[model samples]
Target: MQSNAQTPDQYIEELPEDRKIAISNLRKVILENLPEGFQETMSYGMIGYVVPHSLYPSGYHCTPNLPLPFLSIASQKNFIAVYNMLVYSDPTINEWFVNEYTKYSKAKLDMGKSCIRFKKLDQIPFDLIGELASKVTVDEWINIYEAQLKR
Candidate 1:
């Protein structure tokens, strides 16, 4: 389920009290590790990391008016979710993330093509998440998105 929050702080404020700490920690990790040029905003009613128009004027391919998405954090009804587009666009990165998460985590990873679901705060490995967030540079993401357009 999406939130109605217009800003990151608002989103955090609206989250259930139990979920706030984990979300805040994850947001901190994302902000600290994310490459320069990716701005944090509320997109799709979730906390989003994006390459703003200044860096990529084309915006998102599916929705040209919006900034190009990089990653997003959401509080779902059943669990917390993290969507990383870089993992979806690049197979090698995807493979590395999956392998590393599995290797490092005690619990089985609950993940989809791009979204990683966490049933509890401890389910998330902050180091691995940070690596995934830092892996793709802005130029790399733009290149990947542009290449997808050609396909």
Candidate 2:
């Protein structure tokens, strides 16, 4: 579900008590491990980590006015979702994440193209997510994003 909150802090504050901690922890890990050049902001009605326009003036292809989104964390209707563009855009990263997920949690990976869903909050793998956030640099993501656009 999308949020109407204007800031990341506000978004977290509005979540149900059951979800507040999990989403907060997820946000903590992402912000701590996310590489420099990526800025945290409220994006697409979720807490988003993006490559700001100062670095990539083209912004997103679909929404050119907005910054290039790299990752986002949202509390969905039934689960908390981590939307990671690196896993969606790069096959190597996707393969690595899929393989590594098994090492972190016993629960089956509930995932979409880029959205990793955690129905059981206790099973969320914070470290794996953090490492994934660190795997791609701003330059790399921009390159990968541009390449995909050309295809």
Candidate 3:
């Protein structure tokens, strides 16, 4: 769940072999499709993709000391997790992801408001994950996050 690793590379390197592979694959897909401007860092003890402070100086708003987080992938004690703040914040994206995942995945969708959990690497819906990562740019995420603050 939480990683004390200072960097994403360190986090991955510290994982057990099997977990490293799964996290690495997931990280690859995320990086390949991630919208520009989101930086990868270690946050909340996990490998996180965030809208940097330079891009959104207000920081996380909830915790201004932290960067505005967008997504994260981690190897937990029991299973791996993919956390997507965009899906949690946007009902439309959440609905679409749920529907598409159920329709296409053989693996069960174990998810919360923002975290998707799975025991195996293949259980992750790579295509859907990539799409979700690509849907929102940094500027768009800032607008959305700021709008929510106003509400």
Candidates in order, TM-scores: namely 0.96, 0.98, 0.94
lDDT of 2 by residue, 39-141 (tens): 9999999999999999999999999999999999999999999999989989999999999999999999999999999999999999999999999889999
Kindly report which residue pairs in candidate 3 clash with one another: 3-45
lDDT tens digits by residue: candidate 3, 7-77:
88889999999888888888898999998999999889998999998888889977998999999988888
lDDT of 3: 0.88
Candidate 1 residues 1-151, lDDT tens each? 8888888999999888878888998999999999998999999989999999999998997899999999999999998999999888888898899889877688888989889999977778977888889997899889988887788
Can you rank all candidates by lDDT, best first? 2, 1, 3
Could you tell me which 10 consecutive residues in candidate 1 have the lowest summed lDDT? 120-129
Off by over 4 Å in 1: none
What is the alpha-carbon lDDT of model 1 when measured against the actual structure?
Answer: 0.89
- Superior by TM-score: candidate 2 or candidate 3: 2
Candidate rank order under TM-score: 2, 1, 3
Model 3 TM: 0.94
Q: How does each model score on lDDT?
A: 0.89, 0.95, 0.88
Q: After superposing candidate 2, which stretches have Cα over 4 Å from the reference?
A: none
Winning candidate number (TM-score): 2
